[model samples]
Target: MAGREGPRPGGRSARVQASVHGAVQALMTRMERAEITIPMIAVEAGVTPSTIYRRWGDIQELLADVAVERLKPDMQPVDTGNGGKDLLAWAEQYAEEMSSKPGREMIRDVLAAQDGGGAYQCCNFTKQQIDVIAARAAGRGEAFPEADAVMDRVVSPIMYRILFGEAPDTAHVARLVSGAMGLVSKAPASV
Candidate 1:
């Protein structure tokens, strides 16, 4: 009967919920940088290992969820009434975000895990992000094939730079964006 709180199960409260969520994010950040076994994370977060497991189900699930939470892709599609400008904006923003230290590390972690089909599993969240772009492009009468081609080009190089630590300067981003635009322009109207 001692230490029992009214109404809340497991002695958890709304404020405690926020803290646990924050702890999860912090743990994921650490994990992305290096090995982060659950026990270490639990100790760092001041929570029991059971609490982490109960909240996230498993390590992979926790990582995937955290990665999904971090990737806030701009949902706006290239439709500034001038397709080229919109596409360029997308490229610049995407490049800037992906090149950041934490962003690159998170992506690298997810990609490395992809070997055991974990990549595809974790990618469901990312695909939703792509769908947003697709929707936005479609809304502006942009062809799906063109949009897809453009995005593929724009994202691929950024990923490459992130993984390899290669330079992705403004010139590089512009070039890639331009290349993608060229492809999109040449793509067949349908399919």
Candidate 2:
């Protein structure tokens, strides 16, 4: 799909996308997101409004494009040396971030995207992080829930809350994590 990344990854298309995405990010820091318009973004990025419209279709899609980029996992979940702790820490942080104004906006945008590619990408990003945590836990001889189970049991509720104007508190996140952890199957004891 023709996202902020564009159809091609090199040369003018990439450059234009980067410039546009950069422009949107820069704008977000200074002003309320709702007040910003495509014209303003185009001016900041040095592209015409039509360029953005052609690429993203509308403002919501453009925002979703930018939000997906922002939502990408930058680093692996902090290794706490214990599987449950690692997941607890990660889930707490995830809940907080996705509950914030910007985070909430990003989630909404991803859900609003026409092609639903942004939603898929965001889900994949979360699952990848969970998988990493689970893999790391396994390496340490710790039991951890499958990433899918965590996604369904832990992350899904969190997202549902955020989407419906209910930002999850730490207690909520802790409970979700604890519940998800229950899904892990202990490895067979070594003979």
Candidate 3:
């Protein structure tokens, strides 16, 4: 086959990444993280085990990559002309997703892999999401909320509850969003 001759350059590499990512996602839907092996992923992705090992080294790294890619917030920023409202909307969406079954599974898997040192970087996904929101607020001439503040006030609460066996409901998320907005409003201009 085309891929068997050797690495087929950019197009084939992209295809392999997509296939492996898709396989990981599909397996996550049907199997626990501990049960997912590199061999199984390679089989599902229609690639050799060596290919997976060569690219990712192990299942933890692969899982981290998959989680980061799958968990990225949509790039389009919410532009409601009010930075607080836009931030609230974004936080609410994030809270809702993190509370869902699949979302919880993804978080669990990624966190479990963090001890290996590769998965902690997946948290950068949240940083990127915040950057997108901050840029949108700036574009609207509104005060941009500090990313660290948003993380502590908004994301941290939801994640804490998730890890503790309680998923925040919409009302709770709304409250968290409001609290985050309050912090942003009171934050010094230098923030």
TM-score of every candidate relative to the true structure: 0.62, 0.91, 0.77
Cα shift from native, residue 173, model 1 (Å): 1.5
C-alpha lDDT (0 to 100) for residue 71 of candidate 1: 69
Report each candidate's C-alpha RMSD, comma-separated, in the order given.
7.6, 2.3, 5.5
Task: Compute the lDDT for candidate 2.
Answer: 0.88
Error of model 3, residue 73, in angstroms? 2.1
Query: By the TM-score metric, which is better: model 2 or model 3?
Result: 2
| lDDT of model 2 at position 159 | 91
* Residue-by-residue lDDT tens digits, candidate 3, 1-191: 11223345778888998999999889877987789999999999999999998777678767866776777666665767777777777777887788888788667657756343334555677867777778877775667668888888888998999889688887888898787777655543443
**Per-residue lDDT for 21-136 in model 1, tens only?**
56767766565535777677677667888876666555655555455556645455455554556666666766777778767665755564423334554344444555665666
Point to the candidate with the largest lDDT: 2
**Ten-residue region with minimum lDDT total, candidate 2:** 182-191
TM-score of 3: 0.77
The list of candidate 2 runs beyond 4 A from truth reads 1-6, 186-191
Clashing pairs in 1: 114-119
Q: Put down candidate 2 lDDT per residue, 1-191, tens digits, no spaces.
A: 45455567699888888999999999989998889999999999999999888878888988998999999989989998988899999999999999998898898888887889899999999999999898888887787888889999889999999888688899988999999887766663243
